[model samples]
Target: MTLVPYAGSSAPASASVAELRPRPKSYVSRIWRHGPNDGVPLFRIDAAIDPATIEDRALSAALAPFAAQLQDLSIYVLHAEEVKPLAPWAVGRLDVDEKSAHVFLHDYLAAPNGMLMLNLFQAPGAVADIVMGVAPMVVEPRRIHFAITDYDIGIRASIG
Candidate 1:
């Protein structure tokens, strides 16, 4: 699925606000089921809140024990937006319908600052860091459509 970034103001408050409520009883929810092979136990971790909202000191403190305990696993303290599918399908959809693409750009550029996806992932810290890093990086939405059409048929065909 394409990662639909929630702009800071538009994002759900709970995802961005930490002091707004009491410390949640838990962050990690582990689910276990039988695996397809060998009947081995399969596990997945479902965290309730985004880690970027937590204060740095608190995050370090919480991670300390886990860091000590989990020696084998790589402790990749990455931002929530760090790993997501590229939104090539969005460009493809725009190419197929030029009028809709123009309308989309008109609507996006009507704002003081046009929105562009950050092409790279970031490390953990204040969630505002993500916004600040992307603020100066701007691209014309129409060019995005052109790049997809001119460069790659794979991208154009991926959507429709």
Candidate 2:
């Protein structure tokens, strides 16, 4: 499936912006409708993160679960100056879960300067809610910061 948004979609204040709010100071996250009028809306999360780890095997190392559940994957890298002027991504869905999508976001932030509009087309349910039920894990933190240059998300069917 493709992910994107129509015109006036980049305003960040549009009605569609609601799900993307409560965003991180340098990040944005939310969930929204993912189909035609009759389609179900899946949860979506976005973050502008560091691109350092991109091309490294480590990036894919932790993707086992995500890949098992992922229908597809796409990523974009934005330089510092292009953070704004981001166009809304036009995206479409196959069948997906929300939990997978949210967890994908959480993992995405762990990636080292990049902007990820992750569409985990699997409704895995709310992982956060379930995690809150369990004891938290302890691990060393590895923070990756992004320097966005420009951002945009518009849809286009797979060309393969």
Q: What tens-digit string does per-residue lDDT give for candidate 1 at 14-120? A: 33321201111111222244565523221111112232443544432332333322222211112223223123221111111212211011122122332121111
lDDT of 2 by residue, 79-156 (tens): 223223222231211112322222222222223422333332222331211110001111112211111112233222
**In model 2, which range of ten residues has the least summed lDDT?**
128-137
Report each candidate's C-alpha RMSD, comma-separated, in the order given. Answer: 20.8, 18.0
Q: Tell me the spans in candidate 1 whose CA falls farther than 4 Å from its real position.
A: 1-55, 74-160
The prediction achieving the highest TM-score against the true structure is 2
